[model samples]
Target: MASLETRVTEFQENLARNSVNEIKEQIKEMQKMEESQNFVLKDCHEKTQNMLKRIVELEKTDFDDKFNHITRRMIGEVVREHLTPIQMNFNLENKSIKKLVEEHAYTIEQ
Candidate 1:
């Protein structure tokens, strides 16, 4: 009876040791998984930051292009508005000068 009790006690000790080892191994595996997840999270964060920066650059370029186009169009409109009448007046003056020159030439010929 004593030998049988000793054997049972030994068996229980071995089972407890195995359970402790298994728990330790499971903790190690969880730590490794946590490390892997952290790495992926860091990579995703970097990619997101890069994408946001690229978006900002693209938006700035687009805004600048639009602003330049609008400025040029406005300048063209202003130039046309201010210069058209001046050009027309210069043309009329040139015609009047040519007519006076022709009249003077005719009188000289006579």
Candidate 2:
């Protein structure tokens, strides 16, 4: 029952509708891809954050270990320096006591 002009108009409207539907589908597909990209970026960001934290921890531990080693070495050197004279005095006193005891024993025997 439609004339040529009406049918032509209907054909144009259907073509426009189909084009709009294709555009909507393409937009949905693009949104899905963008969401997937966002998830990947978020995952990578978390991994990078964890790696930075681990690096900081490793640096701190290494620094603390080196500091402790240097401290212990310095303390050992100071202790050795302070104790050397005391050790020598103790050895001299021990020898003097032994000599005095030997002379006393000889006198007592005589």
| Residues 41-90, model 1: lDDT tens digits | 99999999999999999877877779899999999999999999999999
In candidate 1, which residue pairs get closer than 3 Å at backbone N, Cα or C atoms, i.e. clash? none
* Residue-pair clashes per candidate: 0, 0
Candidate 2: list runs displaced more than 4 Å.
63-110
Residue range 1-110, candidate 2, lDDT tens digits: 99999999999999999999999999999999999999999999999999999999987787777989999999999999999999999999999999999999999999
By lDDT, who's the top model here?
2
